[model samples]
Target: MSDGIPLIPVIPQALREAAHRGTLIPFVGAGASRLAGCPTWAQLADGALMACITANKFNHGQMEQIRHLSPRMKLSIARAIESEHALTIDYEKLINPFDGYQNNAVGHRVYRSLGKLSKTFVTTNYDAWLDTEILDPPLSVSTDSPVQDTVATPRVRRRIANVEDFTPANLNQENCVFHIHGSLVDPAGMVMTTRDYIRRYANDRGSDDPTRENRTLTFLEVLFQHKTVLFVGYGLEDLEILEYVIQKARQQFPSERPQARHFMLQGYFAHEYELMRSLTQYYAQCDIELIPFRRDQRDWGQLTEVLEAFAEAMPARAPLELQVQMEMESYLEP
Candidate 1:
């Protein structure tokens, strides 16, 4: 079945339908912000280079000639920061602005849409962009007032205190967001350092300590329980995340009975087929439908147009019953 619309390309029909039904949960990744003039991972590496030089930590020319490093080498750079003190400084400098993008407009739109759609959310981003966008007046739980009740609003954002806070009640709220890697404003909660990723994912087996536990798995469990996941910014590059997700998901659902539809917008075409193949195997024990989006230009106008069309074509069901009516109102109200 198609949406019967030509304006929107139904490249991934299943995903289109799910998005319309509001069953599609978006998993925003770094690439989503690139279009809005933000830096990509390679750019971040270059930023790391610049940061190293400005701090007088490393010889700029050492990395000047190097355009790109292999994935293994990048991982090594991340790993080296644990012991190499100056490199640690370079790592923080590189990641600080990387985390700062959360406050940008691209980040704002991403989170605002999530507030409009997904039943719940889990972002690996350490920035407060998503939380800031959805949290009205943007109150921090660590602040004096702590929680601001938004039960009356169309959208509500709540900060997950720790692993123990990932209960059904919190996850299923009208519009809830959980920052798995923590946020920038909350330095103690931030998980940018290589040591943090290593410690969190390495000791990921269920734990009694609330703070030390793997909230990623909890998030994934809630994610898998859902029918569809719309992965936005995730590129499946981080070893800790890729490995833990693959390993834990396999262990939890040893059988292929309960499967969830997984969607990812692919920015690079040459890597698409290979990445999809690997993802299929990584998620072998779990059932998943990989959706790849090819964007020659970074406009992403095509993708959004398709999403708008899909959202338009959604069946007149409970959640989406007012979609067309809203469209009409949008056209007529003003």
Candidate 2:
């Protein structure tokens, strides 16, 4: 069924090379979790806002106003709820629904495939699905749970909240799962409100502030600068982080040259040539190559098919003889 879906000619080979070279990193988005029964940002925000308004016993006029707002206006609702209730919305509650939901086939396959290729995974999701279901066996190496591996073998199952925690040692160890926007384990760390966004992306506290002053942005810049990022399960609506990174890149690297170390797998239709062209050019400014999976229908199953094909096309692990030869060559170098 998925074979009918089309991809840009060079995407498969390009992705294959990155996987073989261990340079490819998966940047998961909310769509991946949605596949696993988790709600989207709009859904979570709308639900939480409605609950808060009802709990507070607002007047009929105010209640009607809240009820009439579109789901897309969730952020605004969240802010209103915060102001009226004087309570911080716990986004962890939204992620709780995914706690025990069985893994969706597509998400399971995508992550399993990713685990075979790279050691590090990065995402903005608050759910624990990636840590609990996908990157499971390695046991999340940490100070409390140390991993025993030789230099030739690296463990990549650890999860970190902040970008600063992604140290040189962690990067070298591989298999590090970074939740750049906090995880369910830490509700206080989650960035949900408009105030949180301002603090994270707008406020500038100079070089000393970790909350602002471009610390997180710099971390992303450094990460993207060195790794080949493959963006999966993301749509145009989920462009906040991508847009921020692009803005930072432009400010940091003002050169006219284009960079293309990142790729995004998105769905497109046959008749949307103008839209595709415009989006391609728009992302080109950020040096991200957009690979569109041609969709005959509007369903998301095509994404799963594309991912499955991509994973299947990845070259198998190097042969034992080649591994031994490489090890011997490295041993002789010193």
lDDT of each: 0.51, 0.62
- lDDT of candidate 2 over 61-157, digit per residue (tens): 6646766565446555566657666766666666656443343545555555555556667888877656632433344457886774211222336
The sequence of per-residue lDDT tens digits that candidate 1 reaches over residues 1-334 is: 1222133334467765665665555665555445434566666656655555665655656664554674334434533533365344333344445454443444444444444545556666544445533433444566566574331222335666375676544544545567766654464555645566665555444566776656566556656654476666556564356556545744655654544567654343433556556764655434554444445443454455444343445421222545434433533442
For residue 186, what is the lDDT in candidate 2?
Answer: 74
TM-scores for the candidates? 0.62, 0.74
Q: How accurate is candidate 1 locally (lDDT)?
A: 0.51
Residue pairs of candidate 2 with colliding backbone atoms:
119-175, 156-175
Name model 1 segments beyond 4 Å from true: 1-23, 61-115, 132-156, 187-189, 203-213, 236-240, 267-286, 297-301, 307-334
lDDT of 2 at 287: 74
* TM-score of candidate 1 versus the correct structure, residues matched by position: 0.62
Best by lDDT: 2
